[model samples]
Target: MNKIRNGSTVVLLVAVSTIMAIFIACGGETIREVEVVKIVEKEVPVEVIKEVPVDKVVKEVVTEYITETVTETVIEIEEVEVIKEVPKPVQVEIEKLVIVTPTPGPKVEETWVPTGTFVGVSNETYTMSGYAPDCVYCATMVHLGVQESLFGTKRGDAGELVLDPWAVSSWETASDFSYTDFKARENVPFHRGFGDMDANDIVWYFNSINPLTNPDSRNDTGGQMGGTLLETSVVDDSTARFHWDAFAGHTLFKTFTDLEEGMGIFSKKAYDERGEDWIKDNMIGTGPFQLVEWIEAERVEMDAVTNHWRKTPYVNRVEILFVPENATRRAMLETTQAYAGNLPIKDWQSMFDMGFGLAPESIYTVTQIAMSGNYWEYSHIKTGDTLERVRDISKPHVGDPYEGGGTTFDGNTPSMQQSLKVRQALSRTIDRETINDVILGGLGEEHHLGYVWNNDPIWQENADAWSLPYDPDGGKALLTEAGYPDGFDIEWYVGTGDYETQQAVAADWLSKLDVNVTFDRQDYSSWRPTIVARTNSDIFGGCCWGPLLWPFEWTSNTSSFPGGYGIGMELPQSKASFNIKNGSQDQAELKAAAVDMLQYLNDWALFPGVVQQPNAAMYNPDMISWQEMRPYLWMRLGGMRSFEYIQLK
Candidate 1:
């Protein structure tokens, strides 16, 4: 018998032989020569079998037969004795083994080397005003690295809102949330030979932009300031304190850090010497770029600051040209004449197909219909007696637009605007799907509520109840029931750009409901002042006002409330907003107040939202690299691209 072990298996071979006795006594000698042969085989006894323990950590010896190589060798245990039988001989062959070890993974090296000149084009021209830009387009110059505020706010890598240290090093709020103290960074130099920025510069900048302090200063962004900033006091050369009238500490800080409305800190000496006219044409600030030449309504050229305190500009220079024609901008990008440009949705796919980078961002801009409830023609006669009652009950506790001598709809006779049924009927006449698909080229979200984002939890929860179903027949019936059986004539004012096309499409859909509409196409420059001054007494169709940068601003008296500086729509939700602001800071109380305000706005439908359009821009990826674009408090300004972080690939 013989035994051999291979890997996990053990084999045993056994041989047996049978012997027959000779019949004759004389054959006894011959029988002694009996031959042995194999007959039967049997397994070894259980008691004689050696047991191999399971789950034991044993080194495996692998042998390669092809080249007779020993792949692995385990010398832990010595060879055991082999069992043998003399009946026959058996041959055994051995294979050589070789050992092999795994190699480590490849290493990855990543780096971003910044260099080159960045050139971009814009559809709108920059006004380059002294205090505030006439148009929002001029504000993009600050984002282009020419100017910076005391503090900067942006979405961090983790998607949370973060206030980054810029001119301001650190800050803290008061216990009552009425004020915030900011410590300015030291040794931050201003461009164009202005001395370093300090607490004095901070105080001067805010006061210059504040309408209360500098009445001569043209602050188009004053509306977004929320009328909360009372004063800015210089505590010392390195620190400053911002005081507010109400408990608006958080909002006040946000307003200072906001990319659009927030005033950029300027050199007090420069302004005092050069004056407002010179400051308009020339910019001096603590930024990564210095303005070289700014040709009003034509082009702007800036040179990069090589040794900036915060971050040096990667590009040597930045040139922004005003190409109002979309086709011209598109051609520039295609020909590589411009590194980046504002792209229309219709041209986005084509640009992307051509290997250009496409950055699409969600802006605070929404296109909606602003029905002037204050118009005597639309006034609700039935509610004329209750106008005073509504005004008294819904007046806000703070931030009253009427305080600034701004007229509200409170004194207007309540007419059709007071009827919820009429508003709902008018809302139903709008074909949001058609506008989103046709006019916007499928680059928009259908919104149900005004001012509030559709994705917000408050709106999401009550969207169904707030949304008006698109039913022209039902709308016609409702209109007839509201005493306009044959439809009423409305003077529809449509501004230039997307608004012109959108309102035209909407007017077509509204005609199906027997609504008589006359379209008045006007340029944005002319239309903006009219809307801002509340001179558009008739139905003014335009894009929704830019996003109220802060959530609290959404409830500010200037935005959603009547008897306040409203955006044409006279909604009676000011009391709710005021109550929420003055109410207990308790989470539950605030949430309840917010919910009540949202419910009131939804029921009123003061401004019927159409669609939230996406803002898109095209760039050359080979020349530039950037993170995801953000609205950065401005819809038209290409998501506030931080020129400091943008690297040239």
Candidate 2:
């Protein structure tokens, strides 16, 4: 039966092929040849196919062909049968195709080569501490040309404080803010061929100043500034990561970016070979300028670095002379003996009238009567005690109840200056408006709070609550209630500049409360250490300023006046507020906490803010032109003035 079925299938296939061939042969007159293709069926099992290997298959097919001509056509039909074995499946591997293109390198801009010299005069002199800057002013001088920091803060185009890349190219904080990684730009050279900057150099510089790494080198600025940094890890030749136990908010940025007192990256090669003593006297940095000569308190001379990575200075040389006298500094600018010089507020009107260039913005410097909140040193009296004292003592001379009594508080007893009433009394005595208008020659702002600028959003939000009204009567009443029936004798320490005059004006108002004032005049050099150590007398007057956008930077007990120099002597309220602000993850809550802290400081009367000091520099416009100056954290020196930006007109 199977053989019969197979024979019938073969016959059907042959018949179909023969018909297809005949159709092709008759279809065209053009002499064409036709062939029927093979058709295979595996249903039939022939004797040869059945014996085939298991790895292969056998098939049967039939075929036919025909030919035709134009003149005489010949048709032929044929049938053929064949069987073949199919190969088994095999495994193969394929690879994905990819196309790659090379990236173009960055275009290098031409550096500005300076040809002329720029002469500048200032009231202060450089400390000549190359690796370690002693003061903000000295640090600024180093920043001018001799040293460069990893980052710096500058005013953005939108007038907001923004982080600026300097030595480093980019930085990123970890997801949890535990660490920040930084990448150094390629080919950033160090001054005097100390070698190019790399991650190792950065790690060395950070470790050199970090107290955690080198406890013996506990310099004031380095210790306080690098307090938050835990460890620095070198990720690669060009990358470094700084780890912190906890995030310190904006201060973490400020420590590396602050124009003044920020960590300045030094050359690791130079330090190792040159030694610390040599480094202190000499400067090596990748800044726009190189130190040519430093004559201690006389002068400091610097020459431009023609191929500075960031900018080449406009002037070839900068000669900074130590002219402590305000008049000398003014004369230097007027005669073009120097192109620019520091100007006192008393000289502002005269300089402006003479058509000299005056800085367009106010500096962060605030000249205030800093009262000691050192609870350990002074006896603290409470508001209740003051009220009790007021009840016990009758009002002797009463034009206004706020006016102090004729009798003095007990000299034998240690009195509290930290009392809110005492601070209020002291704040009320000095009229800030008069100070701004008269003593400052209408050149300053009447500031009544600490750590907050009048233009700050935080200040704007809580302006009404922060305002300290001038009330001499109220001041006297508070003082009288605080048991200072007349007034107390307090030593007033002051440095040079307008502070002397401002303090004298304050003394006059303070005397109205029968407060005896003993003036201790000292040169700033002699007075600074005492003030920074918190060893200065009852009242010390100086300029203080910080980043306005970050209120906690100045208010934090761990920073600025209260923390760094023991200005408020570790006030518990400030520390608590600082902790809350630092630990808070929400920005709004942090800001609110900062403002609250500032309000608390104000209430505590840690330092009664008198006025925001005006910073002025006189320059001859015909000889030089300067871009707009931004509000600097260090008001004494204008905001990070780059000689690269300054040009000869």
Candidate 3:
């Protein structure tokens, strides 16, 4: 039966090449038989028989297979267009103005010799009058290499602050931190024939400088160390024991080793023989440099000590010229008359464009507004003397424990609560971002939470809660709520450092709240005595002095010293500071206490931070190739240290 439709066709094709070859081998003349079938349009089939050659059949079969394969593989693809929306282009303008004309620096010599006089122009004067070890400006003498402490600060392998032994060789503290025995290095000679340094000299040095032991002593650091430093005794010629009521070894380390506030060890022989008045004008220390003369408001000349015990100065002589004018200092550097000068931040790029050398990086220093006169302590910690608290309850930013004759740091007190609000208002009124960008030239970052760094663990956790926003309206509301609807007058003290411009900006912001701010601009040396005495109740525009009560990773209280340069800040967290100074060995406990104190500071806004800026160095490339030596914690703006290792190019 045949089942083939009219439209549908079924075709069968077979290839029998092997059978054809067999038949051909049998007889080349033999004829091959073939069959053919035909079907009509209807369901009718017809059959026909035909004969074909084997070659013809094979050719026909191959042709049909190729045609069938080609018919099955025909496919057509359609093309479509895709439309996408394009965003509008934004136009940006770029200005490429030259700051200064490029100039070649001084030519370098083929043979280098580190034996020239280095003249450095500084914006600040050396001191107001005296060279006393306890003076705030005494650190300048130590930084200039004319004096050294028993211990000094240096950069560790990780660029961390480490203690560098100078006069002292080794130390051992009691288990309870009651006392520390320091072994002094022998044969350390003093300048101008003062004789060798000994344990007796160390004992005399600490006792005489401390106001607690010597009532006539005028050292400001007496307030910081006097409470804990009970006595100093000589064990032998090279050993001295410092007895403490309570001591934190780290706090002692920070206070004793600091370059800014540390007591510069002077010769006891000179002090005894020459008297206090002679010692005040003269400097005698076991340092690499010996002071030749200091002309007031002019220059301080020093000659390098040959074969110094600690370090031999590369330069033969050093001259520190007091150049208050920024332009004059820059001019001196450009003319090659000054090896180094403290220039302004705005001029740094221009100076570099003119072939000047800068430091590898800048040292960071925090600037804060110390809301001074927060007298919360009822009595003195050591002497049990009746301490006077803030009497003026009307002062906007002053906290008084004696408010309404109150006897405690009661937060519920009217004056205390009002002062807190005023502080918060002042902090919020500040435009730190704008000030950092404009005044600091982007070299500073917004700083808050007192002395804590931006990325510190405590700051990271509490940043959201602790950070005060820039809200002028909010500040006004706070001031109004604090009973200052018409605002108030504040006497803001500005000392040395890069603070004037920033303070001016802050004052402008403050004016919006009807706050009349009066700035008292004076030399820091003159202001030092008042600040140390805690006599002024006015606010200061600077970092807090003394070791920070907070346990920072760097362990540098001076880095962000609380209490506003040792102002009389008696608060509820005052005992925390006492413990830190007393020498608590427990790190975790200390950190907790520090964090608690920071919280208190933040909530009350007593000591609010503005921004942290860089203290950079700029020098002539030809005069110096390398200027770094030991670590310098806090120096003035554009100030350079470690003069002994300055390499001449």
Task: List, residue by residue over 521-544, the lDDT tens digit for candidate 2.
Answer: 444344445544444434665333
Backbone clash tally (model 1): 13
Instruction: State how far residue 290 of model 3 sits from its true place (Å).
Output: 0.3
lDDT of 3 at 278: 69
- lDDT, residue 62, candidate 2: 11
**Tens-place lDDT digits, model 1, residues 1-649:** 0011111111111111111111101101121333222222111100000011111132211121111111221112111111222222221121221212123233232233346877888754433554442222334445666677765655544333344557776666575656678877777888867788899888887776565565544444444444466678999998888886554313533455544344567788877887766665566777777777766445667777776776666777777776657788889888888878776655665666688865422333566665553321122221333222122212111012232233453332223332445566777777787666665566556866665556444455578788867788887777677666776555555432334334443464456655555555443333445444444454554333321212343433233222112344334454445435442333344445656665765665556777764454568887787654322445443333565655666
Write down the TM-score of every candidate: 0.69, 0.71, 0.76
lDDT minimum window of 10 residues, candidate 3: 42-51
Which has the better TM-score: candidate 2, or candidate 3?
Answer: 3
Candidate 2 whole-model C-alpha lDDT, 0 to 1: 0.52
State how far residue 317 of model 1 sits from its true place (Å): 2.0
Instruction: Give the per-residue Cα lDDT of candidate 1 at 66.
Output: 16
lDDT of 2 at 23: 18
The candidate 1 region of ten consecutive residues with least summed lDDT is 42-51
Residue 623, candidate 2: C-alpha displacement in angstroms: 0.3
lDDT, residue 141, candidate 2: 45
Per-residue accuracy of model 3 over 392-419 as CA lDDT, tens digit each = 6667887676667656557778887898
